[model samples]
Target: MTQTFIPAVFYRGGSSKGLFFHARHCPPDHAVLERMLLSALGSPDPYGRQLDGMGGGTSSLSKAVIIGPPTHPDADVDYTFAQVAVDRPVVDWGANCGNLSSAVGPFAVDEGLVCAADGEALVRIHQVNTKKIIHARFPVRNGKAVTTGNATVDGVAGTGAPIALDFLDPGGTVTSGLLPTGQVIETIEIDGRAFDMSLVDASNPVAFVAANDVGLAGSEHPDTIETDRAVMALLDRLRRAAAVRMGLGQTPDSVGLANPKIAVVSAPATFVTLDGRTVEGAAQDIAIRMLSMERAHRAVTLTGAMCLAVACRIEGSLPHRLCSGHADMQAIRVAHPSGIVEAGATVFQRGNGWHVESGRVYRTARRLMQGEVAIAPFEGEGDR
Candidate 1:
């Protein structure tokens, strides 16, 4: 079989990594695009390891991004994110990957898609999936984005330049409004039991449940959480039910694997990190454990952190009730299995309802590789 090459760049943005492509180099038809991405990432591998492709066998590592000229008037470029399932032939575009969003600006600047002078460069990004504008501010030198600095993200090792992401009006990203179900708190019954959760849609829709309600301390490592089959099954059911409530799907069985992520939250507690470091309870405002692609995430997703931050500010949400003392603080420190990540949200109550002015987080991104990714030629294409 002959192979075809597509120009792409591999980037590690925050804690997640993915392949980035220029829009001009990709086929316009989404069917063909999905096929190419699946092949390049080696999906549908029953063994759960994408050994034949670029994927690193996890949700955080199985991703693809496309960059193009802006379609929105307020943006400098267009950014689309795709989450490729490692063990299934599925590509979910229903939600945005906040971790990888940090790389879009640097990718644009380095590729000459956007011009920036030396100093703090600002790139207005049109997040296609969420229909939101993310203002990315980072340092630039010699006409390129600087990649070295003192900033460090929790999941990633070492320090790199910081990328400040301000999600403007990051409410109702994938739903009708911030409080998707028109309520700050709701109860969903699964397996003949009622579970109380907050379904908020800031940046990304998430169903936040108290850790004790799920029989957890919320400080467990990813491996420990993943090994608990009953908890995992319950979380999936809750996520699907929340998706239906948020109008992302008609029924629980029809919900996609990406959107409306389910998170378990608790008041801050002392715990040990994956790297064997100790995290004091008082150091963080709240603790969280999130699942992605049906696996316990080692660290909380950036968007999840932002959404939790926003949830903490809401009057009666579960997160707010758990961390009521820090509800009015500008920044909310979240404790995940990895450590602590700080996120901030500006929210206010209006006559209509609660309004989120913006959600902000800082991340680091670096271009790991720049070249072409080889894939088998399409079935109908002739050999070159």
Candidate 2:
């Protein structure tokens, strides 16, 4: 039997990595693409380790991105991100990957999908899943995107050229407004205990709860958070309750931790980072521990950063309480498990409530391996 080959490029964007595919080369049918993606990533492995395919098992690595010529009049490219489940044969097209979104501009510039200038290129991307615009700006040395520089970000090691991503009108991408539940804070009863949380809609829908409320010191390592089964189960229940309040209408058992993520936030007080460096309370405005797919995120997602940026500005919110004296600052440095990430946001009160005009963050990306990824024939489907 002849194996099917698909042209794809693997890239490391921010802290996560994913396979980037050209829309022109991908199967036009959604069903076909769905199966192909699962095979390419070796999903439904049950062992949760994608040992036979391109995926690295974790949620951040089990991803695929589809890009093409601009679909919107104001954008230079159309980007659709896919989150492939490592343990199940499911491809959730429910939200965009903020880390992977940083790579789209460089991919577009290299693939000839869009032309770029010699110095810097501004790529206007139409994010398909969320119906949002991500303005990606990066330096271009020579005729291609620059991959080397001194710019550094948390989670990712070393430094590289910076990619500035501005999410315009980032609010309400997945919900009705900035406060998806129509309130800055809401208390839910879980197992006879009341937990107050804020559901904010930025680049994605996220439920913010204080670290103390979720049983954490806010400075614990990912290993500690991931290994504690009881803690994880508690977070799942909290996330599911949030999903209901936010109108996500999906249970954690069925949905498997995404779309509307849960983040445990803490106030800015001296704490040690994952790398053993003490982060002074004065250096950061707030501390965050974001959960991606039910596990602790090494660093905050670009979307999560955007969500936190907005949350910090909303009065009475968990993040806002911790981020005191930063209401007038243009940017908020979010201290996560990895390090500090500074995200900028423009927010103000509108007719009804507080609104986020945009959210911005800096990231870097590099094309790793580019070639044809051969995949086995799908079950019941003939070889391509």
Candidate 3:
């Protein structure tokens, strides 16, 4: 066969979109799977625009997911996330996509992977990449996951049914512990300059730095930040340095492109959002700007926001210091370029170290399309 077609479903989960497949339809060979995903997403495109495939030419849009029976006894289904690089042939499985996670339960219910009745339904998901459990709860009617509701997610237009996600025991997702270096706050040297940062790993690992230290206001638009070559280079250097310290990699170059995200943060400040709305500093507790797949994220990643919320609860962390005035609040208001998102985290210090009980957030997802995705056949591959 000149081409192969794989059954897939396209979904918009929170602020991100990805193609979903059942484990039964995927190739068992790791190498073949990588090639299929890369081709299906139109990766390795020098133009940075994935016009040839379903990808939307950004980190959040170039993604894939696999769902099957849960390997962990405590979960209902297994959800694995794959981050497909837009300009490279690499697919990073080092971390989980919190945005896409919201859709897993709905997909599972709609696809018959799980049984549900009317009213609210809960699907315990085993996040394969991070080895974590995410409890996804949403509304169900007529034996189908509800898609129409009044909930509004900042980065997404229109309203949809709200999905509440609770990440249990979210600490130490990709590193040694919540505070990877065994300190709430630490300093990393980049270009001979010492900069204070907090390396926190909750739903995902993130390196939080002061925006002022990096010569930024933390409210800059994604395009504006991406255009600044000097600032981009500096952030990458700091992120790599922190990754090494977090034990994600032995060398800076060994770190994967998706894990150990770097974020610039500051106290809430007035800023214009991508949708032309002005948000006041007083309306939010803290402001953030995060990077993913080497590009500025239009909005903060959901896991990154959850991690930031956990960091804010840590007394001495940079996020905590920035938003200390409202540190006592149960929910944290995170201001990003696209607007504001609220995340809640429960944490407390034990004799040995700090422990995170859970991180919570609300998002909406929609199934945009369901069909087979076509890809060119690889060499030596036969028709099934």
Candidate 4:
């Protein structure tokens, strides 16, 4: 059988990388799309290595984003994101990819779907999966997207022009409101282990638990944590419990569930980062160890960081209790495995509950390559 050639742009969006495609160039059929994307990413491999395709094996690198003309009146582009599993036939479409959302603006401008005005350009994107609007502001010089600048993100090496992403009215992204459980804190008994956690919904739905509550110091490196099977399983159970409590599912055993990310957080303390540098408490508001696809993330996610930033300001939240009282709430610096990520949310009092007007994160994106991706005829397609 002849392989299908689909045009896509391979991009490095902050810490995650994916294939960016225009909707006009992709197959409209869902069956064909599943085969195409899985083949493009080399999914369902028992070996856990996606060596036969574009995926880099890890969840962060096994992603794809589809962009096109806006379907919403307030947006300039329609963005659909997909998280393809490396070792399984699962394509999780339950949430948006905040990191890849950073690159949609540049792809829109370059694809002629939207024209950016000279100087700084503001691109309003409609995230189809979550039905949220994201406003991206990036520098445009000589009618092209600027890729280099002085902005230095913790995970990405070198500096680049800052692409400011503002997720407006970010509450209820996957759930109903900022506090999905309608409670500041909830306790669950999982397999005889009692765990306390807070569920917050800003840019995304996340379960925040104190590291100490989970028998973790919040200072362990990602490599150490990832390799420990007991620790990973323990965190997964807590995360699943949070998901059921947040109404994502009936129980932890629910099938095909993947939203409501889980993060183990703690007060800022001295910790050796992934790059061998020490992150002192004085330099960060809080420390975090978030999981993506059941594996520890090397850096904090854009959406997860946004939720943490908002949770830090709430009156009675886990992150708030852990965050060192800071004079600048707009720059909530969070220490992660990579280094420190500054995530901010425009949050304030609206009676007894918190209201987040918008959340801001600075990320940089680069168009790695733009060409046709060939998907061979495979017997099975992946599901997420």
Tens digits of lDDT, candidate 1, 1-384? 488899999999999999999999999999999989998998878998999899999999999999999999999999999999999989999899999999999999999999999999999999999999999999999999999999999878999999999999999999999999889999999878998999999999999998888889888999998999999999999999999999999989999999989999999889999999999988999999999889889999999999999999989899999873554587999999989999999998998689999999999999999999988776788768
Ranking of predictions according to lDDT:
3, 1, 2, 4
Candidate 4, residues 217-328: lDDT per residue as tens digits?
A: 9988777888988888888888888888888888688824357888999998988877788777899889999888877888988889888998988877888888995436
Once fitted onto the true fold, the runs of candidate 1 whose alpha carbons sit more than 4 angstroms away are 324-327, 378-384
**Residue-level error in angstroms, candidate 3, position 274:** 0.3
Which candidate do you rate higher for TM-score, 2 or 3?
3
TM-scores, in order shown?
A: 0.98, 0.96, 0.98, 0.96
Worst 10 residues of 1 by lDDT: 321-330
lDDT of each: 0.93, 0.87, 0.94, 0.86
In model 2, the Cα lDDT at residue 7 comes to: 97
Task: Kindly list the per-residue Cα lDDT of model 2 for residues 60-147, writing each as its tens digit.
Answer: 8899999987779989999999999888878988888999999999999888877887887999999999999999999986668999
Residue-level lDDT tens digits of model 3 in 168-243: 9999987888898999888898768999999999999999999999999888999999999999999999999899
Give Cα distance to truth, residue 190, candidate 3, Å. 1.5
Clashing pairs in 3: none
Clashes of 2: 0
